[model samples]
Target: MSFLNTLNLTGKDKSVGLLLGLILLSHTERTGAKDKSNVVQKGKGSTAKLKEIMIGRCFNYLGTINPNAGNKDCSKLWEAFLRAFSEKDPCKITKEDYKPFLNMADHDIPIGQSIFWSQTKELILQYTDVTHKVMPLENTLIGFMLDGLNWCGKLSSPGPNYEACPEWNSCTNHSMGSFWRAASENYAMKAQGEVTVLLNGSANAFRENSIFREIELGKLDSKRVTSVHLWIMDNIDGPDKESCGVGSVAVLENILKEKKIKYTCVDNYKPVKMLQCVFKLDRPSCNTGT
Candidate 1:
């Protein structure tokens, strides 16, 4: 028996089967094309997820303090948690939101003291890059700083962490780049992030000492600088040294304004024991080399 006749179907039935086969072939082709287009989109989505995973893992690893504070196992768990809850609402406030604050006036109620927002931005950037990879610098400074101080537990209480060590006055502690990066990355809502001016010794006498040093060292160029946060530290050893004085504030403000540099002075605010300040510069317009 011939293959066509073996089925014992009518001529109409044969034609119907042939038509169905053609339809199936066409459908297969269309499905394949759709899948090909989706491949590119899928790859992009996968890459974004992978980047997030890498950053979160690295950040967790660097932030680890004690032998058990954050282990590799803890990081894996944290990663899973973040992935599950990764859908952050755009309305939620983030650290970068402080960039606009430089434009706000000094007397602006809440904005006047919002030092944490910008600082957190600096911290985040330091830890994660555009690809979300954890940078080594985060490991060295923030990690070491946290680890040495025992961070959360140590800084929380008035123990050795509160002790006024000579290290606080050193370049490492006062470095703008390090401070900026750490501040930008810190995500804690409770962190003071407020700029504090420690006016010790003669407040007016050496109010501009740090600023002058920065300028002399060619770190700060008056015209190129857009704004600067002032931290006036004086007589750190004196009995009443911790008090933020009025004279320092007046002198620093007058000098900064006279230089045509938009600025804000945050005095007597101590998030931690350290006196902190922030400075903003117009990168493109800055005559000073970055």
Candidate 2:
């Protein structure tokens, strides 16, 4: 009190100091609110952007394949697809949850043109693109839409949780894993006539747990499909481990035989070997087609 009296503090000075303090507090609060708003906005914006890209690409591919496919409202499709996993436990999402979206995109896969691959994604894509004789899963509308994308959502969140999503092996019922399981089942069930499978000969080419072995093999209808053509492609650098009637491939043959589904295995088919040679011309294995 003595110091205030010495300085001659009056009502106007006191009021001015209080007003300045209030302004500073208000500004700080406003800035913090704006920052929080921006963070929320950015998260929402990113999720929307991903949806747009995925749905847009799907529609574009559909339109290119079937002109009437463009008439479908893909935005609605996106909404339906997101609703499958959004606001749900990432580990609890199931193949059945994706049935709605699948129904919307359902179409017949060209018989005999269906190609399945295990650890041969690159070569199969290249082979399909160059030859245009096979239709891999990635060529399908649904597969084209979600391939290589990671997404999940929470009940508390409004959109996909871009911060973190489970990996393929992290959980049995992971969102992406469920989607692929559902998609593979559809693809396999729809396949007819002769179906081609491209396998990597260098590794365990045919494993029971592989999608090709578990989903595709089980779904193929013996009444519809005449046979299965297994193309075992090895690396140009040697170390070819599996072949027809040998190793894991023989196990695969036994399964097919038991199923009464006629199958033929070709080790390093010349055309595929030629394709490999395009990438590694100097490799003796590539040159010799061994």
The candidate that achieves the highest TM-score relative to the unseen native structure: 2
After superposing candidate 1 on the true structure, give the runs of residues whose Cα lies further than 4 Å from its correct spot.
Answer: 1-10, 40-56, 59-290
lDDT of 2 by residue, 28-146 (tens): 89877754432342222123467878878877887785554345668887888899888776767999999999888776677798899998898998898889888788887778888
- Cα lDDT for residue 228, model 1? 54
lDDT of 1 at 188: 19
